[model samples]
Target: MATPLWLAGCVAAPKPSVQATLPPAPPPTLAPVEVEPAAPATQPASLFTLITQGPVSAMLSYSEKVRSLNGNELNAELARLGEPGDVPTAQMQTALALAQTRVPADLARAVGLLQRVAANTSAEARPLHPLARMLAARYLEQRRIEDDRDRQVAQLRDAQRRIDQLNDRIEALRAIERSFARPANGAAAAPASNGAKPAP
Candidate 1:
Protein backbone atom coordinates (compact mmCIF):
# COMPACT_ATOMS: atom_id res chain seq x y z
CA MET A 1 0.00 0.00 0.00
CA ALA A 2 1.22 3.52 -0.82
CA THR A 3 1.75 5.91 2.16
CA PRO A 4 1.73 9.74 2.44
CA LEU A 5 4.98 11.51 1.44
CA TRP A 6 5.43 13.04 4.95
CA LEU A 7 5.01 9.59 6.58
CA ALA A 8 7.48 8.04 4.15
CA GLY A 9 9.97 10.81 4.94
CA CYS A 10 9.57 10.16 8.74
CA VAL A 11 10.22 6.39 8.27
CA ALA A 12 13.25 7.04 6.07
CA ALA A 13 14.69 9.28 8.91
CA PRO A 14 17.39 7.48 11.02
CA LYS A 15 16.35 6.03 14.44
CA PRO A 16 17.53 7.97 17.61
CA SER A 17 21.24 7.19 18.38
CA VAL A 18 22.26 5.52 21.76
CA GLN A 19 25.62 6.47 23.35
CA ALA A 20 28.06 3.75 24.83
CA THR A 21 28.93 3.96 28.58
CA LEU A 22 32.52 3.35 29.98
CA PRO A 23 33.45 2.07 33.52
CA PRO A 24 34.92 4.60 36.07
CA ALA A 25 38.79 4.89 36.28
CA PRO A 26 40.73 3.42 39.33
CA PRO A 27 42.49 5.70 42.05
CA PRO A 28 46.26 6.33 41.70
CA THR A 29 48.65 4.38 44.02
CA LEU A 30 50.94 6.32 46.52
CA ALA A 31 54.69 5.67 47.13
CA PRO A 32 55.72 3.90 50.36
CA VAL A 33 57.41 5.94 53.23
CA GLU A 34 60.15 4.77 55.68
CA VAL A 35 59.72 5.34 59.44
CA GLU A 36 62.61 5.62 61.93
CA PRO A 37 62.74 3.63 65.15
CA ALA A 38 62.25 5.51 68.44
CA ALA A 39 65.15 5.88 70.86
CA PRO A 40 65.08 4.43 74.41
CA ALA A 41 64.61 6.74 77.41
CA THR A 42 67.70 7.47 79.57
CA GLN A 43 68.13 8.89 83.10
CA PRO A 44 70.31 11.92 83.73
CA ALA A 45 73.67 11.52 85.44
CA SER A 46 73.99 12.42 89.16
CA LEU A 47 76.42 15.15 90.37
CA PHE A 48 78.39 12.70 92.53
CA THR A 49 79.02 10.38 89.60
CA LEU A 50 79.92 13.26 87.32
CA ILE A 51 82.49 14.68 89.77
CA THR A 52 83.99 11.25 90.50
CA GLN A 53 84.64 10.32 86.83
CA GLY A 54 86.05 13.45 85.18
CA PRO A 55 89.44 15.28 85.12
CA VAL A 56 89.05 16.31 88.79
CA SER A 57 88.28 12.76 89.93
CA ALA A 58 91.73 12.03 91.33
CA MET A 59 91.78 15.14 93.48
CA LEU A 60 88.32 14.42 94.89
CA SER A 61 89.22 10.79 95.49
CA TYR A 62 92.45 11.68 97.23
CA SER A 63 90.66 14.21 99.40
CA GLU A 64 88.10 11.60 100.40
CA LYS A 65 90.86 9.10 101.18
CA VAL A 66 92.56 11.65 103.40
CA ARG A 67 89.28 12.28 105.17
CA SER A 68 88.83 8.55 105.89
CA LEU A 69 92.33 8.10 107.29
CA ASN A 70 92.83 7.28 110.99
CA GLY A 71 94.99 9.45 113.24
CA ASN A 72 98.21 7.58 112.46
CA GLU A 73 97.45 7.43 108.72
CA LEU A 74 96.52 11.09 108.68
CA ASN A 75 99.80 12.05 110.35
CA ALA A 76 101.62 9.87 107.85
CA GLU A 77 99.81 11.63 105.01
CA LEU A 78 100.75 15.05 106.36
CA ALA A 79 104.34 13.91 106.80
CA ARG A 80 104.33 12.65 103.24
CA LEU A 81 103.35 16.11 101.97
CA GLY A 82 106.66 17.41 103.33
CA GLU A 83 108.51 15.17 100.88
CA PRO A 84 109.90 16.24 97.48
CA GLY A 85 106.74 15.74 95.45
CA ASP A 86 104.85 18.96 94.60
CA VAL A 87 101.92 17.27 92.92
CA PRO A 88 98.68 19.31 92.72
CA THR A 89 96.47 16.40 93.77
CA ALA A 90 98.68 15.72 96.78
CA GLN A 91 98.61 19.38 97.75
CA MET A 92 94.81 19.44 97.50
CA GLN A 93 94.53 16.29 99.56
CA THR A 94 96.83 17.71 102.18
CA ALA A 95 94.89 20.95 102.28
CA LEU A 96 91.61 19.11 102.71
CA ALA A 97 93.05 17.02 105.53
CA LEU A 98 94.58 20.03 107.23
CA ALA A 99 91.26 21.87 107.01
CA GLN A 100 89.58 19.00 108.82
CA THR A 101 92.06 19.18 111.70
CA ARG A 102 90.68 22.57 112.85
CA VAL A 103 94.06 23.47 114.38
CA PRO A 104 95.05 27.10 113.85
CA ALA A 105 98.49 26.21 112.48
CA ASP A 106 97.13 23.44 110.25
CA LEU A 107 94.31 25.68 109.03
CA ALA A 108 96.82 28.38 108.21
CA ARG A 109 98.84 25.87 106.19
CA ALA A 110 95.70 24.65 104.45
CA VAL A 111 94.72 28.19 103.57
CA GLY A 112 98.14 28.79 102.09
CA LEU A 113 97.93 25.60 100.00
CA LEU A 114 94.41 26.39 98.80
CA GLN A 115 95.43 29.92 97.84
CA ARG A 116 98.38 28.56 95.87
CA VAL A 117 96.19 26.11 94.02
CA ALA A 118 93.61 28.77 93.26
CA ALA A 119 96.27 31.14 91.95
CA ASN A 120 97.53 28.67 89.33
CA THR A 121 96.01 29.63 85.95
CA SER A 122 97.43 26.69 83.94
CA ALA A 123 95.13 24.38 82.04
CA GLU A 124 96.24 21.43 84.15
CA ALA A 125 95.21 23.32 87.29
CA ARG A 126 91.89 24.61 85.90
CA PRO A 127 89.85 21.77 87.34
CA LEU A 128 91.25 22.33 90.82
CA HIS A 129 90.96 26.12 90.72
CA PRO A 130 87.28 26.36 91.63
CA LEU A 131 87.61 23.87 94.46
CA ALA A 132 90.77 25.53 95.71
CA ARG A 133 89.23 29.00 95.68
CA MET A 134 86.15 27.72 97.51
CA LEU A 135 88.20 25.98 100.17
CA ALA A 136 90.42 29.01 100.62
CA ALA A 137 87.40 31.25 101.07
CA ARG A 138 85.91 28.90 103.63
CA TYR A 139 89.18 28.67 105.53
CA LEU A 140 89.58 32.43 105.46
CA GLU A 141 86.12 32.80 106.97
CA GLN A 142 87.00 30.27 109.64
CA ARG A 143 90.18 32.14 110.47
CA ARG A 144 88.28 35.39 110.69
CA ILE A 145 85.75 33.82 113.01
CA GLU A 146 88.53 32.36 115.13
CA ASP A 147 90.26 35.73 115.36
CA ASP A 148 87.00 37.38 116.38
CA ARG A 149 86.37 34.69 118.95
CA ASP A 150 89.87 35.07 120.36
CA ARG A 151 89.44 38.81 120.59
CA GLN A 152 86.09 38.36 122.31
CA VAL A 153 87.63 35.86 124.73
CA ALA A 154 90.43 38.29 125.50
CA GLN A 155 87.95 41.08 126.06
CA LEU A 156 85.88 38.81 128.33
CA ARG A 157 88.98 37.89 130.30
CA ASP A 158 89.89 41.50 130.71
CA ALA A 159 86.34 42.33 131.80
CA GLN A 160 86.40 39.47 134.30
CA ARG A 161 89.73 40.65 135.68
CA ARG A 162 88.39 44.15 136.03
CA ILE A 163 85.30 42.80 137.80
CA ASP A 164 87.53 40.83 140.18
CA GLN A 165 89.60 43.93 140.90
CA LEU A 166 86.42 45.90 141.58
CA ASN A 167 85.20 43.16 143.91
CA ASP A 168 88.51 43.25 145.78
CA ARG A 169 88.29 47.01 146.10
CA ILE A 170 84.70 46.71 147.42
CA GLU A 171 85.84 44.12 150.00
CA ALA A 172 88.69 46.40 151.13
CA LEU A 173 86.28 49.31 151.42
CA ARG A 174 83.88 47.15 153.48
CA ALA A 175 86.72 46.13 155.78
CA ILE A 176 87.67 49.75 156.28
CA GLU A 177 84.02 50.62 157.09
CA ARG A 178 83.84 47.79 159.66
CA SER A 179 87.01 49.03 161.32
CA PHE A 180 85.68 52.58 161.51
CA ALA A 181 82.35 51.32 162.95
CA ARG A 182 84.11 49.39 165.73
CA PRO A 183 86.22 52.39 166.69
CA ALA A 184 83.14 54.71 166.71
CA ASN A 185 81.20 52.28 168.98
CA GLY A 186 84.11 52.07 171.41
CA ALA A 187 84.52 55.82 171.42
CA ALA A 188 80.79 56.34 172.08
CA ALA A 189 80.90 53.88 175.03
CA ALA A 190 83.99 55.66 176.47
CA PRO A 191 82.24 59.07 176.17
CA ALA A 192 79.13 57.69 177.86
CA SER A 193 81.17 56.19 180.73
CA ASN A 194 83.10 59.46 181.20
CA GLY A 195 79.93 61.59 181.27
CA ALA A 196 78.10 62.21 184.66
CA LYS A 197 75.14 59.91 185.45
CA PRO A 198 71.57 61.37 185.51
CA ALA A 199 69.88 61.71 188.99
CA PRO A 200 67.15 59.13 189.80
Candidate 2:
Protein backbone atom coordinates (compact mmCIF):
# COMPACT_ATOMS: atom_id res chain seq x y z
CA MET A 1 0.00 0.00 0.00
CA ALA A 2 3.01 2.67 0.73
CA THR A 3 5.27 4.02 -2.13
CA PRO A 4 9.15 3.72 -1.90
CA LEU A 5 11.57 6.81 -1.88
CA TRP A 6 12.99 5.84 -5.30
CA LEU A 7 9.45 5.76 -6.72
CA ALA A 8 8.59 9.40 -5.34
CA GLY A 9 11.73 10.90 -7.07
CA CYS A 10 10.63 9.45 -10.41
CA VAL A 11 7.14 11.16 -10.07
CA ALA A 12 8.67 14.86 -9.47
CA ALA A 13 9.24 17.45 -12.49
CA PRO A 14 12.41 19.61 -13.29
CA LYS A 15 12.66 23.64 -13.29
CA PRO A 16 14.01 26.07 -16.13
CA SER A 17 16.94 28.68 -15.93
CA VAL A 18 17.37 32.26 -17.88
CA GLN A 19 20.40 34.54 -18.92
CA ALA A 20 20.78 38.50 -18.61
CA THR A 21 22.19 41.18 -21.18
CA LEU A 22 23.13 45.08 -21.24
CA PRO A 23 22.68 47.76 -24.09
CA PRO A 24 25.55 50.00 -25.48
CA ALA A 25 26.22 53.56 -24.04
CA PRO A 26 24.74 56.69 -25.89
CA PRO A 27 26.64 59.85 -27.38
CA PRO A 28 26.96 63.44 -25.77
CA THR A 29 24.60 66.54 -26.44
CA LEU A 30 25.44 70.18 -27.48
CA ALA A 31 24.07 73.93 -27.00
CA PRO A 32 22.77 76.13 -29.92
CA VAL A 33 23.72 79.87 -30.77
CA GLU A 34 21.29 82.68 -31.90
CA VAL A 35 21.62 85.60 -34.44
CA GLU A 36 19.84 89.04 -34.76
CA PRO A 37 17.83 90.35 -37.76
CA ALA A 38 18.49 93.44 -39.99
CA ALA A 39 16.61 96.80 -39.80
CA PRO A 40 13.95 98.08 -42.30
CA ALA A 41 14.38 100.79 -45.03
CA THR A 42 12.95 104.36 -45.70
CA GLN A 43 11.23 106.15 -42.77
CA PRO A 44 8.44 108.78 -43.20
CA ALA A 45 8.94 112.62 -43.14
CA SER A 46 8.22 114.53 -39.87
CA LEU A 47 5.30 116.99 -39.35
CA PHE A 48 7.63 119.99 -38.71
CA THR A 49 9.57 119.25 -41.88
CA LEU A 50 6.30 119.16 -43.82
CA ILE A 51 5.21 122.48 -42.37
CA THR A 52 8.56 124.25 -42.96
CA GLN A 53 8.87 122.83 -46.48
CA GLY A 54 5.44 124.13 -47.44
CA PRO A 55 6.21 127.78 -46.59
CA VAL A 56 9.74 127.48 -48.00
CA SER A 57 8.47 126.16 -51.34
CA ALA A 58 5.77 128.81 -51.46
CA MET A 59 8.35 131.60 -50.90
CA LEU A 60 10.58 130.24 -53.65
CA SER A 61 7.70 130.01 -56.12
CA TYR A 62 6.49 133.54 -55.30
CA SER A 63 10.02 134.93 -55.66
CA GLU A 64 10.32 133.39 -59.10
CA LYS A 65 6.99 134.93 -60.09
CA VAL A 66 8.16 138.38 -58.87
CA ARG A 67 11.38 138.09 -60.89
CA SER A 68 9.49 137.24 -64.04
CA LEU A 69 7.23 140.26 -63.62
CA ASN A 70 9.97 142.69 -62.59
CA GLY A 71 8.23 146.10 -62.08
CA ASN A 72 6.26 146.34 -65.35
CA GLU A 73 3.94 143.38 -64.73
CA LEU A 74 3.53 143.77 -60.98
CA ASN A 75 -0.29 143.39 -60.91
CA ALA A 76 -0.60 140.34 -63.14
CA GLU A 77 2.59 138.72 -61.80
CA LEU A 78 1.58 139.11 -58.13
CA ALA A 79 -1.82 137.67 -59.04
CA ARG A 80 -0.08 134.60 -60.49
CA LEU A 81 2.20 134.24 -57.42
CA GLY A 82 -0.95 134.13 -55.26
CA GLU A 83 0.55 134.84 -51.79
CA PRO A 84 4.16 135.06 -50.61
CA GLY A 85 3.30 133.48 -47.22
CA ASP A 86 6.57 134.47 -45.51
CA VAL A 87 9.62 132.88 -47.10
CA PRO A 88 10.77 135.03 -50.04
CA THR A 89 8.41 137.93 -49.28
CA ALA A 90 11.12 140.01 -47.60
CA GLN A 91 13.60 138.74 -50.14
CA MET A 92 11.25 139.83 -52.92
CA GLN A 93 11.09 143.31 -51.40
CA THR A 94 14.87 143.51 -51.57
CA ALA A 95 14.67 142.50 -55.21
CA LEU A 96 12.07 145.22 -55.82
CA ALA A 97 14.42 147.86 -54.32
CA LEU A 98 17.20 146.74 -56.66
CA ALA A 99 14.85 146.81 -59.65
CA GLN A 100 13.68 150.29 -58.67
CA THR A 101 17.21 151.69 -59.04
CA ARG A 102 17.25 150.47 -62.67
CA VAL A 103 13.84 152.08 -63.44
CA PRO A 104 13.52 155.22 -61.33
CA ALA A 105 10.64 156.83 -63.32
CA ASP A 106 8.83 153.47 -63.20
CA LEU A 107 8.54 154.12 -59.42
CA ALA A 108 4.75 153.90 -59.71
CA ARG A 109 4.94 150.30 -60.95
CA ALA A 110 7.63 149.60 -58.34
CA VAL A 111 5.28 150.95 -55.66
CA GLY A 112 2.66 148.53 -56.83
CA LEU A 113 5.15 145.67 -56.53
CA LEU A 114 6.08 146.95 -53.06
CA GLN A 115 2.39 146.97 -52.13
CA ARG A 116 2.22 143.31 -53.04
CA VAL A 117 5.26 142.67 -50.86
CA ALA A 118 3.57 144.56 -48.03
CA ALA A 119 0.48 142.37 -48.42
CA ASN A 120 2.63 139.27 -48.09
CA THR A 121 4.38 140.70 -45.04
CA SER A 122 1.06 141.50 -43.39
CA ALA A 123 -0.22 138.01 -44.15
CA GLU A 124 2.91 136.46 -42.75
CA ALA A 125 2.64 138.48 -39.53
CA ARG A 126 -1.10 137.88 -39.08
CA PRO A 127 -2.69 134.52 -38.03
CA LEU A 128 0.92 133.90 -36.93
CA HIS A 129 2.50 131.57 -39.50
CA PRO A 130 5.63 129.55 -38.69
CA LEU A 131 7.86 132.22 -40.27
CA ALA A 132 6.19 134.97 -38.21
CA ARG A 133 6.49 132.86 -35.05
CA MET A 134 10.18 132.29 -35.74
CA LEU A 135 10.75 136.04 -36.28
CA ALA A 136 8.92 136.92 -33.07
CA ALA A 137 11.00 134.45 -31.07
CA ARG A 138 14.18 135.96 -32.55
CA TYR A 139 13.00 139.45 -31.65
CA LEU A 140 12.42 138.29 -28.07
CA GLU A 141 15.97 136.90 -27.94
CA GLN A 142 17.36 140.26 -29.14
CA ARG A 143 15.42 142.08 -26.45
CA ARG A 144 16.83 139.74 -23.80
CA ILE A 145 20.34 140.41 -25.08
CA GLU A 146 19.75 144.18 -24.83
CA ASP A 147 18.38 143.80 -21.32
CA ASP A 148 21.44 141.77 -20.24
CA ARG A 149 23.71 144.46 -21.66
CA ASP A 150 21.85 147.14 -19.71
CA ARG A 151 22.13 145.15 -16.47
CA GLN A 152 25.89 144.63 -16.96
CA VAL A 153 26.31 148.36 -17.64
CA ALA A 154 24.46 149.21 -14.42
CA GLN A 155 26.65 146.76 -12.47
CA LEU A 156 29.78 148.40 -13.92
CA ARG A 157 28.49 151.85 -12.92
CA ASP A 158 27.91 150.61 -9.36
CA ALA A 159 31.46 149.20 -9.25
CA GLN A 160 32.82 152.58 -10.37
CA ARG A 161 30.85 154.32 -7.65
CA ARG A 162 32.35 151.97 -5.02
CA ILE A 163 35.87 152.62 -6.38
CA ASP A 164 35.29 156.36 -6.23
CA GLN A 165 34.15 156.05 -2.59
CA LEU A 166 37.26 154.04 -1.68
CA ASN A 167 39.49 156.62 -3.43
CA ASP A 168 37.86 159.48 -1.51
CA ARG A 169 38.37 157.62 1.82
CA ILE A 170 42.07 157.07 0.98
CA GLU A 171 42.54 160.79 0.13
CA ALA A 172 40.89 161.83 3.41
CA LEU A 173 43.08 159.45 5.44
CA ARG A 174 46.24 160.83 3.70
CA ALA A 175 45.19 164.43 4.58
CA ILE A 176 44.69 163.53 8.29
CA GLU A 177 48.11 161.85 8.43
CA ARG A 178 49.79 164.87 6.75
CA SER A 179 48.29 167.26 9.38
CA PHE A 180 49.65 165.13 12.28
CA ALA A 181 53.11 164.65 10.63
CA ARG A 182 54.45 168.21 11.24
CA PRO A 183 56.44 168.67 14.55
CA ALA A 184 55.69 171.51 17.04
CA ASN A 185 59.36 172.69 16.74
CA GLY A 186 60.22 174.70 13.62
CA ALA A 187 63.09 173.54 11.35
CA ALA A 188 64.78 177.01 11.70
CA ALA A 189 64.96 176.57 15.55
CA ALA A 190 67.39 173.58 15.57
CA PRO A 191 69.91 173.38 18.50
CA ALA A 192 73.64 174.17 18.10
CA SER A 193 74.29 170.38 17.94
CA ASN A 194 72.83 168.36 15.10
CA GLY A 195 69.38 167.00 16.12
CA ALA A 196 70.17 167.70 19.92
CA LYS A 197 68.04 169.58 22.51
CA PRO A 198 69.44 172.91 23.84
CA ALA A 199 70.77 173.01 27.51
CA PRO A 200 67.92 174.14 29.81
Candidate 3:
Protein backbone atom coordinates (compact mmCIF):
# COMPACT_ATOMS: atom_id res chain seq x y z
CA MET A 1 0.00 0.00 0.00
CA ALA A 2 1.39 3.44 -0.91
CA THR A 3 1.08 6.10 1.94
CA PRO A 4 0.43 9.71 1.14
CA LEU A 5 3.71 11.47 0.39
CA TRP A 6 3.08 14.51 2.57
CA LEU A 7 2.11 12.39 5.66
CA ALA A 8 5.02 10.01 5.05
CA GLY A 9 7.40 12.99 4.74
CA CYS A 10 6.13 14.43 8.04
CA VAL A 11 6.53 11.00 9.80
CA ALA A 12 10.04 10.58 8.26
CA ALA A 13 11.23 13.91 9.92
CA PRO A 14 13.37 12.88 12.97
CA LYS A 15 11.45 13.26 16.30
CA PRO A 16 13.06 16.11 18.32
CA SER A 17 14.88 14.80 21.40
CA VAL A 18 12.48 14.89 24.46
CA GLN A 19 15.35 15.09 26.98
CA ALA A 20 16.62 18.68 27.06
CA THR A 21 19.82 19.29 29.12
CA LEU A 22 19.07 21.82 31.87
CA PRO A 23 21.70 24.23 33.33
CA PRO A 24 23.03 22.80 36.63
CA ALA A 25 21.03 24.16 39.67
CA PRO A 26 22.82 27.12 41.18
CA PRO A 27 24.52 26.18 44.55
CA PRO A 28 21.87 26.42 47.27
CA THR A 29 22.35 29.81 49.04
CA LEU A 30 21.87 29.87 52.86
CA ALA A 31 20.16 33.02 54.09
CA PRO A 32 22.29 34.78 56.74
CA VAL A 33 20.79 33.80 60.12
CA GLU A 34 20.19 36.79 62.43
CA VAL A 35 20.97 34.91 65.61
CA GLU A 36 20.28 36.92 68.75
CA PRO A 37 23.41 37.16 70.96
CA ALA A 38 23.04 34.71 73.80
CA ALA A 39 22.15 36.53 76.94
CA PRO A 40 25.19 36.97 79.24
CA ALA A 41 25.35 34.16 81.77
CA THR A 42 24.07 35.32 85.15
CA GLN A 43 26.78 35.60 87.80
CA PRO A 44 26.42 33.75 91.11
CA ALA A 45 25.56 35.71 94.23
CA SER A 46 28.59 36.73 96.37
CA LEU A 47 29.31 35.75 99.97
CA PHE A 48 28.64 39.23 101.22
CA THR A 49 25.23 39.15 99.59
CA LEU A 50 24.48 35.74 101.05
CA ILE A 51 25.56 36.84 104.52
CA THR A 52 23.64 40.08 104.40
CA GLN A 53 20.49 38.49 103.04
CA GLY A 54 20.60 34.99 104.49
CA PRO A 55 19.05 33.60 107.71
CA VAL A 56 21.94 34.76 109.93
CA SER A 57 21.63 38.40 108.88
CA ALA A 58 19.38 39.27 111.79
CA MET A 59 21.82 37.93 114.33
CA LEU A 60 24.67 39.76 112.66
CA SER A 61 22.70 43.01 112.69
CA TYR A 62 21.75 42.56 116.33
CA SER A 63 25.34 41.81 117.26
CA GLU A 64 26.43 45.03 115.61
CA LYS A 65 23.86 46.91 117.66
CA VAL A 66 25.08 45.21 120.79
CA ARG A 67 28.68 46.13 119.96
CA SER A 68 27.76 49.79 119.59
CA LEU A 69 26.03 49.95 122.97
CA ASN A 70 27.67 51.89 125.85
CA GLY A 71 28.53 50.25 129.17
CA ASN A 72 25.44 51.51 130.93
CA GLU A 73 23.25 50.42 128.06
CA LEU A 74 24.96 47.05 127.97
CA ASN A 75 24.35 46.65 131.68
CA ALA A 76 20.71 47.47 131.19
CA GLU A 77 20.61 44.99 128.35
CA LEU A 78 22.10 42.37 130.62
CA ALA A 79 19.52 43.11 133.24
CA ARG A 80 16.77 42.74 130.68
CA LEU A 81 18.26 39.50 129.43
CA GLY A 82 18.28 38.16 132.96
CA GLU A 83 14.51 38.09 132.96
CA PRO A 84 13.08 34.66 132.28
CA GLY A 85 12.85 34.00 128.52
CA ASP A 86 13.49 31.01 126.28
CA VAL A 87 13.64 32.59 122.83
CA PRO A 88 16.73 31.40 120.92
CA THR A 89 17.26 34.72 119.16
CA ALA A 90 17.05 36.55 122.44
CA GLN A 91 19.37 34.04 124.03
CA MET A 92 21.90 34.49 121.24
CA GLN A 93 21.67 38.23 121.51
CA THR A 94 22.14 38.08 125.26
CA ALA A 95 25.13 35.81 124.81
CA LEU A 96 26.68 38.24 122.36
CA ALA A 97 26.15 41.12 124.76
CA LEU A 98 27.54 39.16 127.67
CA ALA A 99 30.64 38.23 125.71
CA GLN A 100 31.43 41.91 125.21
CA THR A 101 31.41 42.62 128.97
CA ARG A 102 34.64 40.64 129.42
CA VAL A 103 33.64 39.85 133.02
CA PRO A 104 34.45 36.27 133.89
CA ALA A 105 30.97 35.45 135.12
CA ASP A 106 29.30 37.08 132.15
CA LEU A 107 31.66 35.42 129.70
CA ALA A 108 30.99 32.11 131.36
CA ARG A 109 27.28 32.64 130.90
CA ALA A 110 27.79 33.58 127.26
CA VAL A 111 29.82 30.45 126.61
CA GLY A 112 27.12 28.35 128.17
CA LEU A 113 24.50 29.93 125.95
CA LEU A 114 26.62 29.46 122.85
CA GLN A 115 27.27 25.85 123.77
CA ARG A 116 23.57 25.28 124.08
CA VAL A 117 22.97 26.76 120.68
CA ALA A 118 25.73 24.71 119.13
CA ALA A 119 24.43 21.52 120.69
CA ASN A 120 20.92 21.97 119.34
CA THR A 121 20.22 19.34 116.69
CA SER A 122 16.81 20.52 115.59
CA ALA A 123 16.37 21.73 112.00
CA GLU A 124 15.01 25.07 113.18
CA ALA A 125 18.25 25.84 115.00
CA ARG A 126 20.69 24.39 112.49
CA PRO A 127 21.55 27.71 110.92
CA LEU A 128 22.76 29.09 114.23
CA HIS A 129 24.89 26.10 115.15
CA PRO A 130 27.96 26.99 113.13
CA LEU A 131 28.00 30.56 114.31
CA ALA A 132 27.43 29.49 117.89
CA ARG A 133 30.23 26.95 117.80
CA MET A 134 32.64 29.43 116.30
CA LEU A 135 31.78 32.06 118.88
CA ALA A 136 32.09 29.57 121.74
CA ALA A 137 35.54 28.49 120.57
CA ARG A 138 36.69 32.09 120.31
CA TYR A 139 35.35 32.98 123.75
CA LEU A 140 36.99 29.94 125.29
CA GLU A 141 40.29 30.95 123.77
CA GLN A 142 39.83 34.46 125.13
CA ARG A 143 39.13 33.03 128.57
CA ARG A 144 42.33 31.02 128.43
CA ILE A 145 44.26 34.14 127.48
CA GLU A 146 42.71 36.09 130.35
CA ASP A 147 43.51 33.33 132.84
CA ASP A 148 47.10 33.29 131.62
CA ARG A 149 47.32 37.06 131.95
CA ASP A 150 45.94 36.94 135.51
CA ARG A 151 48.38 34.21 136.47
CA GLN A 152 51.27 36.17 135.02
CA VAL A 153 50.18 39.27 136.92
CA ALA A 154 50.00 37.34 140.18
CA GLN A 155 53.45 35.89 139.56
CA LEU A 156 54.86 39.35 138.88
CA ARG A 157 53.31 40.68 142.09
CA ASP A 158 54.74 37.76 144.07
CA ALA A 159 58.13 38.30 142.51
CA GLN A 160 58.01 41.99 143.40
CA ARG A 161 57.06 41.16 146.99
CA ARG A 162 59.91 38.67 147.30
CA ILE A 163 62.32 41.26 145.88
CA ASP A 164 61.11 43.75 148.51
CA GLN A 165 61.62 41.17 151.24
CA LEU A 166 65.16 40.43 150.00
CA ASN A 167 65.87 44.15 149.84
CA ASP A 168 64.71 44.50 153.46
CA ARG A 169 66.89 41.58 154.51
CA ILE A 170 69.92 43.08 152.74
CA GLU A 171 69.32 46.41 154.48
CA ALA A 172 69.11 44.64 157.84
CA LEU A 173 72.45 42.86 157.17
CA ARG A 174 74.07 46.19 156.20
CA ALA A 175 72.76 47.75 159.40
CA ILE A 176 74.17 44.89 161.52
CA GLU A 177 77.59 45.20 159.85
CA ARG A 178 77.65 48.93 160.51
CA SER A 179 76.65 48.37 164.15
CA PHE A 180 79.46 45.84 164.67
CA ALA A 181 82.07 48.14 163.13
CA ARG A 182 81.10 50.96 165.51
CA PRO A 183 82.99 51.34 168.80
CA ALA A 184 81.33 50.03 172.03
CA ASN A 185 79.94 53.54 172.42
CA GLY A 186 76.77 54.14 170.39
CA ALA A 187 78.73 56.70 168.24
CA ALA A 188 79.36 55.85 164.60
CA ALA A 189 83.00 55.00 163.65
CA ALA A 190 84.41 58.10 161.94
CA PRO A 191 87.27 58.31 159.41
CA ALA A 192 90.52 59.88 160.69
CA SER A 193 90.92 63.48 159.36
CA ASN A 194 94.32 63.63 157.55
CA GLY A 195 95.29 60.04 156.68
CA ALA A 196 96.96 59.93 160.15
CA LYS A 197 96.68 56.62 162.03
CA PRO A 198 94.52 56.82 165.22
CA ALA A 199 96.36 56.10 168.60
CA PRO A 200 96.21 52.39 169.45
Q: Pick the candidate with the highest TM-score.
A: 3
lDDT of 2 by residue, 1-200 (tens): 25677787688676666555667667666666567333222321222332446544544444454456546577554445454344434434343433423333333443444444434546443332453334334434554666788799999999999999999999999999877766534454555437787668
> Which candidate ranks first by lDDT, i.e. highest?
3
What is the overall TM-score of model 1 with all chains considered together? Answer: 0.61
Candidate 3 residue 143 C-alpha distance from true site, Å? 0.6
TM-score, cand. 2: 0.35
TM-score of each: 0.61, 0.35, 0.63
Q: How much does candidate 3 score in TM-score?
A: 0.63
Q: For model 3, how does the per-residue alpha-carbon lDDT over 1-200 read when each residue is reduced to its tens digit?
A: 45687678778667788998899999999999998643334422222433447646767766777888889999997897684255555667788999888799889989998888777776656888888889899999999999999999999999999999999999999999988877754433344435566679
Q: What's the lDDT for residue 193 in model 2? A: 39
Ranking by lDDT: 3, 1, 2
Runs in model 3 deviating more than 4 A are 1-55, 184-200
Candidate 2 ranges beyond 4 A from true positions:
1-128, 184-189, 192-199
RMSD of each: 13.6, 25.0, 11.9
Clashes of 1: 0
lDDT of 1 by residue, 1-200 (tens): 35787678777667799988988888888778769433322322222433447546656666677777887788887786674245565567678888767689989999988777777776756788888888889899999999899999999999999999999999999999998899878966985788967568
